[model samples]
Target chain A: MRARLLEATVELLVEKGFSGTTTTLVSERAGVSRGAQLHHFPTKNDLVVAAVAHLTERRGEELAERAAELPTGSQRTRAVIQMLGDHFAGPVFTAALELWVAARTDAALLEAVAPLERVLGRETHVMTVELLGADESQPGVRELIQATLDLVRGLGLASTLGDDTRRRRKILDQWALTLDVALDKEKQ
Target chain B: MRARLLEATVELLVEKGFSGTTTTLVSERAGVSRGAQLHHFPTKNDLVVAAVAHLTERRGEELAERAAELPTGSQRTRAVIQMLGDHFAGPVFTAALELWVAARTDAALLEAVAPLERVLGRETHVMTVELLGADESQPGVRELIQATLDLVRGLGLASTLGDDTRRRRKILDQWALTLDVALDKEKQ
Candidate 1:
């Protein structure tokens, strides 16, 4: 029942944003009783924060599995970029985007969501580092890895409104080449 | 009166987001009456869209002026990154973020905002190209300029929730170096 409610929350958030996802609406969508929802989550914040954390952890694991399959080299870098591009354009990102906007004005939401964002950011950053086989201790290498993440995140945000896949692909290609050059220089 | 209402709308957006920025609140903040507000904007869509367009144009001009003042070479590239970082963390971007989130679920708002976003995106891309003093006619050069924008935009989005300025600066520095090397290689 709790899982169903959380799933409903994610769906409603992606379809209708923070303001539109009322407790009643979520209960209705989940086919869970209003009493059961309150029993599971006393407040909307509890419900939303749990839903995001659950979704993010699942997405993170999926990305890790995908990253583990790629061969090391520029090919892997391109694949990782593609993976992130797809992640950002999906429901997980949409749900997160809605939360970020709502949290901008709602201190309570921000308080609940900020730590979760940090955990997700840190976990993803570590995943990217491992996927690229980057030496984070090296001068400037860590920052470059982060820049790659930042670039992908921005592209993903743009993709939310329109089909930025072609342009995003171009960016990933160019950035992959640049990363190859940077990594080579670092080794020397 | 129109300009004041627009200004109030932007302020409210950055502070309260779309659902929070009611017509009554905007009228009160703008020091205009409900009748005048209605006369000027028949619907909330008209009011919010005009505010974003106005803010985007003003920001575009500010960025152009800033870009024109930078000395050519790697210095200009770094400055442009800094400029974009600041721009993304500002009120204008905040207001735009609200609109984007709201528009995601509201088809009417999406119809109103999509074109303005494209215009702002194009103008910013052109400004970055000019700032880099890059040959847009070249194959990879144009994409590199775009990657820079995408990177900064990503950084800016992250910075909204936390103090990412230090990491953002580090990314800017590394990316600027990578860009310089890429451009140099292209020339040779």
Candidate 2:
């Protein structure tokens, strides 16, 4: 029943935004009684927060999981980067983008997002540190890693805002090239 | 009357989202007759497109104006960067974010955002090109510019969740130091 409500929450969030989504709507979509919702989550904010936490935890785990499966080397590094892309991307990204928009003025929503974004930042920083530990002191490696993150986030923004796919692809490819070069430079 | 309706469009949009915002809501908010709205913007899409376009053009002009008044050299570059931050940022950024969210399922919105984004892209690109015209090929210069942008956008995302003023200042300071190094390298 909790899982059912979780799925319903994701659906409504994608369809309507954070503010527009309500517990009643979630219950209706989940085909469950209002009492059932109250039994699980006493408040609408409780349901939304739980849903967000669930999504956030699961997405980070998935990224780390994929990163784990890759052979330990540059391949692992690349995989981790790719994992980052895939994890907070597309429809999932859209959901985040929606919540981010709402969080601007909605204090409660902003509070809900803090822990989730913190988890994401930690995952990103830890994964990046592991990947670039060998080159930690290189003049520009740290900067590049930080900048690459910036690029990824920017691309996510551009992609979501109907920017040209071809342009986004080109930018990502260039970023990959720049990273590979910087990593290689550190080796030399 | 048109300006009054545009103001209401923004109010309703801020209160509701793309889907929730409606002509009736706008009319009620503006205290204008529905017929007057139709006279200005015959459809909801038409009204929103007008509002977005108005906002974009205003931002473009502001960026230009800010870029003009700044001192030359690094000061100028930093000012331009700040202008870019000021242009596509703040509450408008969240609204811009929603447009991206809306574009996924709404073809009309997807269509609507393209030219708007293009204009935004061009506006920023023109200033960047002007600033970097002499030596854009300098290693890390473009990357630094991109990094600055990413940092700004990152702050947008970070601030959406909570007060991220410290992180934002760190990124901006890093941008300044990094840009100085990269630019100095080009001169050498």
Candidate 3:
């Protein structure tokens, strides 16, 4: 029931945004009773905040699951970037985007979301380094990793407006080649 | 009075978001009479949409004005990237972000803001090509330009969470170097 409610909350957040989401809507979508919903989450804030945490954990797990399957050798950099591009363009990112924008004006949301976001961000960075097998101790390597994340994230924003897949693919491919040179992954 | 109302709308959009912004708040902030505000914008939709268009034009003009001051030769690429970084991290970008997130769930706003966004995106792309003085006729050049824009825009998103300026600078500087190599600008 808790899982269903949280899943419903995420869907509402993506579909209707923070303002448009409510306990009633979540309860209906989750097929859980209003009383049960209220018992679990006393307020909209508590519900949405818990949902974000749920989403963050799912993102981390998804990243790990995907990372386990990543290819090694010369294709790894491009493959890693491709993996990230898809991750950012998916539902988790869109759902998180809603909370992020709402958090800009809602201080309580900000307090709740900020630290989790930082952890997710740091983890993503570390994972990217490992997946690419790049040495951060090398000059310019760390920034390149950061750049790859930012590039995919920006591409994610473009996807929000419409299907930016074709253009995004080209950009990501180009970035992959650049990363290969910067990190010397080709020689590896 | 129209300009004042539009300005106030943008300010409120940045500070309070679209749902929190109302004609009453705009009028109060602009110091315009309720009658004048209503006359200029009959609905909140009309007011906010107009403000976005207003904001888009300002972004274009600001880009031009800043573009004129950009230095030539070796430092130019880095300068251009830095300029774009600043532009995306400022109040205008924050104001636009609120609309972008709101427009996700708002069909009416999506209908209104989409075209302006497309036009602005195209112009920004064209402007970036010219500023970097790159030959898009060459392969990969176009994608590199797109990558640069996406990178800074992602950096802009990062800034919204907290003061990411220092880390953003390192990434941009690294990107400028990568761009220089990709565009073969250093050889030129």
- The most accurate candidate by TM-score is 3
DockQ for all models: 0.84, 0.33, 0.84
| Candidate 3 residue A98 C-alpha distance from true site, Å | 0.5
Q: DockQ-based ranking, best first?
A: 1, 3, 2
Q: Name the regions of candidate 1 deviating beyond 4 angstroms.
A: A185-188, B185-188
In the range A1-188, model 2's lDDT, one tens digit per residue, is: 89889778877887776666888899999999999889999977678777766776676676667666766644554555565555544556666767666665567767777677677677787677775453657655565566556556766766666555555444454455455655563332
Cα lDDT tens digits for candidate 1, B89-151: 788988988898899899999999998888888888887776666787777888898888888
Ranking by lDDT: 3, 1, 2
Q: CA shift at B132, candidate 3, in angstroms?
A: 0.6
Docking class of 1: high
- TM-scores for every candidate against the unseen true structure: 0.95, 0.78, 0.97
* Model 3, span B80-181: residue lDDT tens: 999999988988888888888788889998888788788878888999999988899999899989888898888888798884789999999999988898
- Give the clashing pairs for model 3: none
Specify the CAPRI tier of model 2.
Answer: acceptable
C-alpha local distance difference test of each model: 0.85, 0.65, 0.88
Q: Taking the tens digit of each residue's C-alpha lDDT, what string does model 3 give over A61-109?
A: 9889988988877777778899999999988898888888888889998
